[model samples]
Target: MLADGGSRGLLRKTFGELGLLSLSAFLFAFSFPSFISVDGLWPLVFIALIPIVPVIHRCSWAAAPFYGAFYGFLSYAVFNYWLTTFHPLAIFIVPVIYAVYFLILFPALKAVDLFFPRYAYWIQAVVWVGYEYLRTQGFLGYPYGNLGYALYKVLPLIQISELTGVWGVSFLIALIGFFLGHALLFTFEYDASFFVSLKVWFSRRKAALAVCSVLLVGTLIFGFVVMRGSYDDQRPWKVALIQHNADTWKGGLPTYRRNLRTMIALSDRALAADEPEAVIWSETAFVPGVDWHSRYRTDSERYALVEELRNYLADKSVPFILGNDDGQKADPGLPPVLSDGRLNRVDYNAVLLYENGKLRQTYRKTHLVPFTEHFPYKKLFPGFYQLLVDHNYHFWEKGTEYTVFETDNGVHFSTPICFEDVFGYLSRRFVRNGADVIVNLTNDSWSGSVAAQMQHMGMAVFRAVELRRSVIRSSNSGMTCTINPDGRLTGMLEPFAEDYYIGSVPIYAERNTLYYHWGDWFPLVMLSLGLVLLLVGGVRKIVLRKS
Candidate 1:
């Protein structure tokens, strides 16, 4: 009877703690762009994870992993709920997969807390940043929704991205959250006076707290200095971005034609206002078969549409950077067999530059979306490829080169198609290869959510700040805007609106940034430190066992 009562009591306690952890996860999720739409609420991110810290500290090491996994599952599921609009299956699968990440993360973090109890706060920051860096690696690496992105509106705080990439900002947030959590736990949970609790906390964590304070103050001062520096003397070039809110996926041929004409009309209206040097279009704006090579131009319907756009550009006499499809014939050496038993010719999602109605430069999309664009390990599983084909998925061949386009007026830019703009290293590569500005062509029509578009645009802002280059983003559904070198959003177009924006972006002659030269070194160093700590821990266990 006593054993049964004890079992029930333990279960009740477990459930109660789980409820508090879930609340913490909810707070964390709400700190992101979707739930907390207002810019000022960004500071809430510093306290979002505080609730989870007590739960972690109170739980046994064996139970800590489960708590961490559950927290991750709840947090990511809420933050990424918008993905369910595109794929209902993702609601279950995405959270489960992301939860596995925290399963590994919490155990490692628990080990740190056990080994270095005194410096747990600082070590926790390192572990969290290391995990974030790991999340951005390889085929499944998705760096979206990192805590740093929440600080996009807090421009001065985010300037540290130039030195430490997004990982540094995430580390600062985690450090502050841990410190505050410790203070709260000491005061309320331990029944101590606030001043006494704070004093105890400061005495125990003086080194970590002092170092974090120095870093915070230094970063803010550096950001203020950088913000005050003038880039006004740089040459400015006027550019027009057009957005035609069309359901390109569902609305068949008729919808495509209407969207194209609407884009042209909007461009015409923008030109009437003032003749811009170049007019930009969103990704996949035209029907397929607009390749630079003539051999792939066999489809008459596609050819006619391409001709119409070319004639319009020629008449306007403005250089156009428009997104379309390009193709090349299958190589005799090696070619993929299609679902229809035909030799697969390579297809590319590309952006083309047109001057006087003639194709001048073609930049194919390099980083394709994981599942939607191309399956990563298809060669290992033929059945997966067949399943994708059965569902009418169009997989694209990855482009090889980092191609840059030069306008007639000698302005240099590189176009990162779709969500490729989210990648910091990819954008840095372009700037290193002589790109003065970063132009992104994207189609966010399928999302059908303003929050998704805004979230995407927010990440792109970091790219501009990291490279000190102007970023021009033209999206099919919305968020057609210009981000200046300082990461300020200007000339923003409304989502789901058929409109255009004309803005002058400064083109600095010199492109110099520490991040542009040394990419993601902060995260790399954190990852290395984590590995060294693990090695040391393993060695210590071995030494103790032998003794």
Candidate 2:
């Protein structure tokens, strides 16, 4: 009986320690979102200071790994809770995979701290930022839910990203975390003689406080100046985004007639209130198939449907754009079998621009989704390809070139479908090639949870800030909105419901962001500096051992 009681007590203590470990980690990561929100500046940076207080107390290097693990689990669990929908196993599995970053982060941090005792915490903090920068780049880069993304709602602070990308804004937040950590540690007492004890150090603490005050003043001044200089009066055009909250599962031919009617009604309402020069609809709003009026038993049925759309726009006299599937007879052959000995070949997903009831331009989606839209091993594994096709997951051939649609209003816009807009370099290519604005058509209905919608929108804000261009995003199942050049959500529609809102997307033509001009070279430079510090620490350790 005593043994059982002892076992329970031990378990309780272990759980208590773990809970503190989690809380300590949470303090460092939790306030990250507020850093980029409409919330004011100083509090976001203040929370970054708390984690270092425990580390500086006795400096137990073992706590670093525990801190890392706790922080990683909390961050991923909160942000990526939607991964469960992709596969039932992902709820536990995704967090385990993401935890590797923290597992690597802390041990490396403790090693740097042990080698460079004078500024070990600062050095570790800087290296931490370098690790974050690396994770968000490269071909396998998944930059979703970064700490900087929490600040997406904070316009004035994020304006600096125009010069440095999201990595730059992340670096600034990291710097604040490290500085606050240092100041907290600076407040501690020293173990020495009466002359060199904390009583005297308390007097010297005033100097440290003064230095921190100066840093605070400098950051505010720099942020204010940058915010003021970011806006340009010489901009280009205004775009209108139409968000039809449609469900992907219910988005087949069965609901085609109803979907068309709802969208037309919304467009008429928008045109009535605030007539935006250009209007856009979400992805896959129209499903194209080979039935071709055979089901209706009339040759003019297909033509009539298109004519209905044309007549509606002509009546209002406004240009319209929407997503549709484009497929045509592949070769010069008989009805069923073409020259390729297959059925009618469909050209994947495309955006159709209708101006004055005439088709003006068509831009096909270039980057296909990895597993959902296109299978990676189609040629190697024919059976897998057959499974994907049979499942009706529309895998389209990727477009070879970037197509910028020219509007009658003299504005050129580029289309980024779904996750394609999340890439910094890809978004850069469009703006660099003379695109006035970036339009995103995404369908988030497959993601049933709110976290997935917010995470996706978070990535979109970073692109707008980095490019210094306006973004009009139209999404299925909510989060449809427009972002100004500085990454503010100028207008937004609610998610997971059937609704539409009209708002003007002011187009800006600034091509002078340092990030746009130079790419990720600056962040790479900071990373190189961290690598040098790591190398120097290793060499110093070797020298000390030899001595």
TM-scores of the models, in the order given: 0.93, 0.77
Please state the error at residue 222 of candidate 2 in Å: 3.1
Worst 10 residues of 2 by lDDT: 290-299
The per-model lDDT (C-alpha) reads: 0.80, 0.66
For every candidate in turn, the CA RMSD to the true structure comes to 2.7, 5.7
lDDT against true structure, model 2: 0.66
Model 1 misplaced stretches (Cα beyond 4 Å): 35-40, 188-196, 292-297, 332-344, 383-385, 509-511, 541-547
| lDDT by residue (tens digit), candidate 1, 117-212 | 666667777878888888877766677768788788888888888888878888899888877776666676655788987787788777777888
Cα RMSD for candidate 2?
5.7
